[model samples]
Target: MQLSTAVERFLTAVQLEYGYSEHTLRAYQRDLAWFIDFAEETGARELADCDIELMRGWLWQRQQQGLAATTLARNVATLKSFGTWLERSRLVPGNPASRLRAPKAPRDLPRVLADEQMRRLLARVEGRGDAEHPESLRDHAVLELLYAAALRVSELCSLPITGLDAGARTVRVLGKGGKERVVPFGGPAARAIDTYLTVARPALIARAAQAASAASQSAASQSAGPQSARHDALFVGNRGGKLTPNAVYRLVARELEDEPGGGPRGPHTFRHTAATHLLNGGADLRVVQEMLGHSSLASTQVYTHVSTERLAQSYRQAHPRA
Candidate 1:
């Protein structure tokens, strides 16, 4: 079958069956599109005409184009998925790409903020910002929850009001691959969210509705349906819409712009910092994995390396013996 046609079918199936997110779907589609273009360059009529050797050539071409190991690995993975799908549909006799492989990418230790740095950073945020504006309150709550729960930016933004369990101090998060996990937060996050929900959110919604009222009566009539549906969104924009991940990035960037001792100034920096701090405080690896919603312990194990590196650095600096 045509490789491009097969790619479309596979993407649609994954979208419908596995519920892949738009971000994930776009990545896979892009990888497959690259493969089809490469296959055409090699004069293959369709995916059925391509074999393991051609797959290796495609990977080699990507490497020659200066693609990183991670990109090469992703391309190999894309081909494997396509090959498996082709086999299942009887377009190919067996999964040819099961034999495919790529170079392992060099893994960098996650950048963790020092305990003192985190304390100072959060304290600065607390003292510097105005509490009256809804956007300001939302940013505060979002940052607190991001650090408290080690949340991905997408997961943080998708959170709903019902996700918070105030009594238990836990937030039920829907993570990647549509997996749901309950993660606990601290008192600071709880208080920040309480202020945003009770004071800021209602005010923001009212402000949006009032503005819409003056603009168009038709907009006002239809507003109730959408507002009712989105009422559960934990964080909202100034215009009373679901807060997006990009807005979260800008909030974090603006807050971190003047902060000291930074490796990365993005939201994931908080995630890395939180995970490393948990491990430093002797949180169990398995427990941290569950809290972070990582599918594998290996993914969670990266923090242990970060923890050990810090320990080694401290020992070297403090010990008197040469």
Candidate 2:
């Protein structure tokens, strides 16, 4: 089969059968397209033409173009998974990419804020501008929930109005692979979400809905489609649609723009902080795994490395004979 045809089929199978999210499908599509482009450049268009050498060459070409090792590793994984499927479907003589490998990507431990840092940051967030501004109220809740629940930005952005269990102080997150889980937060998160829902969210929703109505009439179509005048989305954007992941990133970045913690300033920083803090507070590894919505304990175990580094740092600073 043609390499491009194989990629399309693989995308369809993964999306329809395996229920991969749009984000994941798009990532695979992008990498596979890159590989197909490289293959075509080499005049090998058939899926059957892909062998270990061809696959490794493609990876090397990407490295020459300055791709990171992690990116190369992911491309390797995608290619192997695709090759396995091609074998299962009898389109290839064997899993040609089975022997392909990538450079070992360094496991950069996630950047985490200390307990004191988080407290100070949250205090600053709470006092940012007038607390009554609709956007300010929403920002406080977003940061609070992110730290409390260890939510990926996508999961947090896609939250529906019904996802919150206010009385229980828990959130129902639709995670990767479309899996759903209920994670509890602290009283602070609960309070922030409540304030947003009761006061700020409605205002932002109405403001955006009005703008959307006008824009829809002015233009026949738009990129994000015709947004409804109302929706059940928990976090509405300034444009009145659901809160987008990009907006979340900008919000968090701006909030922490001057933070001296010296690391990533996005939503995942909060996620990392939440996980590390949980581990530091003596929470069980499996429990932290479940909280982070990590499908594997290995994924959650990286925070343990972060915890160990912090412990060693503390020891060196405090020991008399260091």
lDDT per model, in order? 0.83, 0.86
- Candidate 1 residue-wise lDDT, 14-130, digit = tens: 789877777788888898788888888878767677789888988888899998998898888778877887789887889989899778999988777888877777777666546
Cα lDDT tens digits for candidate 2, 161-206: 7998898888899999888999999988888888888888877777
**Model 2 lDDT-worst window of ten:** 220-229
**lDDT for residue 61 in candidate 2, whole number 0-100:** 92
- TM-score to native of every candidate shown: 0.92, 0.92
Q: Total clashing residue pairs per candidate?
A: 0, 0
For candidate 1, the per-residue lDDT at 106 reads: 100
Q: Candidate 1's C-alpha lDDT?
A: 0.83
Clashing pairs in 2: none
